[model samples]
Target: MNKKVVVVTGAGGVLCSTLAQAFAKEGHLVAVLDLNQEAAVNVANAIVGAGGTAMGVMANVLEKDSLEAARKTIHSTFGPCDILVNGAGGNHPLGTTSKPYLEPQDLNSTVDGFKSFFDLDSAGIQFTFNLNFIGTLLPTQVFARDMVNREGCSILNISSMNAFTPLTKIPAYSGAKAAVSNFTQWLAVHFSKVGIRVNALAPGFFLTEQNRALLTEPDGSLTQRGQTIIDQTPMGKFGSPEDLVSTTLWLSGEGASFITGIVVPVDGGFSAFSGV
Candidate 1:
């Protein structure tokens, strides 16, 4: 395959950082994009040290102006983007409920910091929605414009297992991810004529900085929620970041030329099990 310019949003995060490195290793000119400029720079520097071409860029997927600026930088630095990995997404604490379910008594009860489902803040829900769903949409608008009719051009969306079925106590995240998966299919069909393949990866539980506290105790043992996830997962463990690398590369390369509009699960059988 010819060398291509790859852009990865949220490249500073654990999963995306690993992905950025993997793409760089494949001899692609990587544009490491993140809201956190420092983290993005670090990842890019590491890639450069390891003999990969990369440049850290600060961008906000929510804002078109920011993305446009990033586009100029990327185009001038490494030509138009051939691959875009929409990886900038995470859940918010305020969008989560203190308990998994709601009861009549809980609605009237007033406890400090205890939020029932009814207490879910609209702003929090909107923030989560915009972060995952709109975030993915806006970046595609800005970047995919350049990718149109470009050979080997493709998009990889970062979906979650929650996209398949709602997870407990995190309705906002689940809904947002579902939107992402839905949008992935929509984009695949929409861009098919233009030669941009769109697909998503609905990853199972992987302990990252965003969900570290929720999945593990302070002592590093699995939390109750984490254990529950493990029990449901036939593999009985969290996936390593590296585990996702091969599939990501496959979808980005010509090997998956005929594949599009599918959400591949890297969840280690989590999606296949029915909890029976």
Candidate 2:
């Protein structure tokens, strides 16, 4: 395997951190980029402690200047990025509805903190859209320049099952992920001439710190929403961070050289079931 410099945005997060470590394990130089400096450094340090080469970088995916700064640091430390993983994305509470369905009285409801579809904050929606879609786009713009015309270079985006089927109460997140999936295809075609392969992984529900409270109770039991997700999923459970490692590695390596413009679903059959 070629030892490439792999830059993973949001590497501090559970899923992306796993991807970062996996790349390092394969002898690639890893740039663990995150908005939180401490989290990024911790993950990078852990990889180094395990005998892998990695560096932590602070970057905000939504800001072009921040990403450019990160790219400069990565270039100086590990050379140009050969593999870019756009993993910096998440949902905001204001972009989500308090309930799955709006009631007849919701328009006139006086309940505290009640948010319906009509009540969704515009700022929250924009933030979600920018974080997921623009977050992926900006990173590619900044890091993909190094990959142009380079052999074995690739880009991996973290899409979500919500892209295939919209999840209730989180229209902003679902729509944003859908945009990501669409952009993956667009980017794959756009980068084809440059020999840089672009693809996305539409993951199913994974139990990460970002969604732990929504999925599980304090006692480790499933919440109502989590139970619904499990029942809908053919696998009957939430996915683990480790569950995504192999697919991510496969997509990043030469094994998937011929694969591009495709969004692989790693959702354990969640996308296949129709709830019949």
Candidate 3:
């Protein structure tokens, strides 16, 4: 495979950092972008230390100006991006309900921290939407220009299993990811004439820093919610960040040249199980 210029947003996080390293290992020039400058620098430095070509860039996916600045830096350092991965997204506590179902008495209860669907914060919901959907959009706008009409270039989005089915608590995240899936299809069609392939990876139940507290106890044991996921997943385990690497590479590489507008699940059969 020819060495390509690959840019991965959210590289400071667990999944995207793994992705950045994997791309670099494959002999691609990588730009590790994140809102957190320190985290981005750390991941990029690690890749460079491992004998890969990489540079860290600070970028806020939500802000067009920040994304444009990062794009300029990446273009100057790595040439035009041949592959782009939009991975900056997560759930917000404020957008999540404390419980799955709404109950009659719960609505009238005076519990201090009780949050139902009705109690979901509008600001939190907006934040989730902006972070996931708008974040993906702005970055794509700023960087995809380099990919337009460029042969063998592609855009890979980080969607979630929540896009297929709404999770119990995180309605906002679920909806935002759904929009991402929809946008992926739309972009695939819109950019087809420009030679840009668009696709997404819908990951399931991965143990990352973002969800570690909700899934595992401090003692390294599974939490109740984690146990529920395990019971539901056919694999009976949470996925590691590395599980996504192979599929990610395939989707962004020549192997899947004909593929576009699809959201492939790397879910360990979690989406396939029906509790039978």
RMSD of each: 0.8, 0.8, 0.8
Q: Write the per-residue lDDT of candidate 3 for residues 91-199, one digit (tens) a residue.
A: 8899998887888987886888778888889999999999999999998998899988889999999999999999899999999999999999999999999999999
| Candidate 1 residue-wise lDDT, 125-166, digit = tens | 999999999999999999999989878899999999999989
Candidate 3: stretches off by over 4 Å: none
TM-score to true structure, per model: 0.98, 0.98, 0.98
List of clashing residue pairs for candidate 3: none
Off by over 4 Å in 1: none
Q: Lowest-lDDT window of 10 residues in candidate 2? A: 232-241
How displaced is residue 113 in candidate 1, in Å?
A: 0.7
C-alpha lDDT of all candidate models, in order: 0.95, 0.94, 0.94
Clashing pairs in 1: none
Superposed model 2: Cα runs more than 4 Å off: none
lDDT of 1: 0.95
